[model samples]
Target: MLNRRQLLQNGLLCGGAAALSQFPTGMAFADEATRLYWFGSPARAERTLAVVKLFETANPGIKINSEVGGNDYWSKLTTMIAGGNAPDIYQLAPSRFADYARRNATLPLDEFLGKIIRTDKLMPNALKLGSVDGKIAGIPLAINAFALLYDTAIFEQTGLKPPVETTTWDDFAKLCVELTKAIGKPNLWAVGNCARYSYALEAFLVQRGKRLYLDNGQIGFDIEDAKAWYGYWDSLSKAGGCVSAEIQALDKNQIDSNPMSKRNAAMTIAFSNQLVGYQQLAKNKIALTSLPILEGSGQSGLFYKASLHMAVANNVKNPELAAKFLDFFINDLEAGKALGVERGVPLNLAVRDVVAPTVDEVSKRSIDYISSIADRVGDFPPQVPIGASELEERVYRPIADKLGFGLLSVAEAAQELISQANRILKL
Candidate 1:
């Protein structure tokens, strides 16, 4: 009779517990063995369960108790940690990791890196994404960057050439307008979306050689930067190159509701891993392209965002075993082959090479997409400031929604965002 929130808070879901009972390793492991609870989204269950089975076969003493928490994972994890019952090892988003690290709820992985973690096998940027305050705080499983995913059919029908390496943001916006007018469908937006919260805006700053927040715990970019970024998207929104606020609300921004999925949008901006999910929903062939850049932009604002991380909780009973399991998860070839970039492409270079041949055509496209702009990518962003999470979900997005809805002018929205973000971070 327990609801999802209650089940998640207790580290067990009703049907979820039943589902895990069916995993090959679920029931047989001894109680005395090391148990690690993994918090992951339900959408990630199938691939994660597959990886767990392989890990169990190779290492019998470690019993991984996995739960598919869906969107409740983070909220429940926060509650558990506050109540002194954090999961032994759980998946964390890079954006939220800092808040956890700042609170000392996450354990540092420095000692385990040399002994168990294969430091030489990971990209420096990949390694840094998991670090907070100079301490390696998590074991990264996969990395990705936002990309332009275009529907081949939509482009062909509209007679617009497919996107490529040199496509600038201006070119992309133009294409959006061209496709929308050519198709003559009011609902068919050119870009799936042109407005989003700080994550999307942060990409703009990165493109302009700025960060969202400086390491000294202050707002990273200027009012002009915010103005410019907001203005560009607002222009697209006003021109109908992007979906209107009402259409976005109707679609709820789900992949199924995206114009790209319905052959309505010629292109959409999304994380590389999302290409697979979008492909699953859309009948047309979906392909990945590098995010559009600014003219003369030296290196891109792009960095390999950690798709997910496995962090040992500070109160974990067996840190050694947790670290060993993490090392095995990342470094083992079989595990990599089993995962096959489902988690956002493997962060481990060795694993990438090992899993390369096994990927489906879509995954090969993603691998190629990441490699195409490899040299253009810039530095890892600093850890999110303490008030940053609130700034994103609460302050930033509401202001962005206002801009998209035409409720606020560019100057007004941009200033409000700058002032609010600065005040939040300064605290």
Candidate 2:
């Protein structure tokens, strides 16, 4: 196999400007029909690539070279663009999109909306998530949300009533304690060690009507709010509300590898779309429950968001062809069937309706859960700032781990975390 530089050089030689300038960005490759490079994470690669394969079958002239951007996808992708090897279309998360948009790394897609891409079939709210500065920078890939997934068998066996939208945070914690006691397994617990997880943190903040950071890149919550957030989870850990740290430390970020898949915990927090992944590896039937409401608030921590996106690169050779391919990915009935809810709920209303009956029982459940909470979910938080990703590794992860491990008091940890957010965001 060719090394990365060689492979990248080969890609350029095969489809780069000098050779393919004749056809524009979307047409057939001069060598053997046009090749469009699509870079993204491996999280949803299997199902997404299936659709691309079908697209290739249908359009004999265009070939999509799907590649993994690996960890720190945005950082790596930016370097590639600087080196003049940008992918034609790529996956983007709303969190990092603003910085990319500001830098002009991605194409502004407003013009393609009703033309080559029929995003009019998508939910209005979903489309808004991918916009930056009032221009559509990316297409909403899937409208994802946060939820608590419970194993039905465990709840039945324990005689615990399943948690509902009415369940308070205190009530949920008590239920978790009860489940942990009932199971009595060394690794078994009721919740996930959700520290180091900004997604779950976002849900908690949003439930309180806060964002992680303001649109102007300022810290959004006070130190006291962070304290309460840490206190709640810390109390759960002390009460055996989540799996042992040893078990959680082994998490590989793959659904099958999670300790939850082995039923080590009765309940775990997950994105609504991830329920489909968890179902495959879980021995027991898993069901979605609304995130527990905070006491006296009556508001949920779950935030329905357009978590991921499909974006064409600023340098894509043919914008029209790229837009057409992307439209097919989201709006085509066949593509929708192949992708299902692997990337989260389909954002297109037409595609969602078409794939509803054909998807597996698990994916269908995911769709239904997301649909049921559509109105209950809060607004999408602002796009994370340029330093957000850096904060995760250097600042948030360390402080969160301290909270998770009981190495520091809640007040101390919260103060430190908030201080770090303020410091890094300014840098």
lDDT of 1 by residue, 81-167 (tens): 777766677777666777778789889999988787777787665777888888988877888887878888777887878777677
Candidate 2: where is the Cα deviation over 4 Å?
1-46, 57-60, 69-76, 252-257
Candidate 1 displacement at residue 262 in angstroms: 6.2
Q: Estimate each model's TM-score.
A: 0.89, 0.87
* TM-score quality measure for candidate 1: 0.89
Give candidate 1's whole-model lDDT: 0.73
Best by lDDT: 2
Q: After superposition, which runs of candidate 1 have C-alpha atoms over 4 Å from their true positions?
A: 1-32, 35-43, 250-259, 262-264, 296-298
What TM-score does prediction 2 earn?
A: 0.87
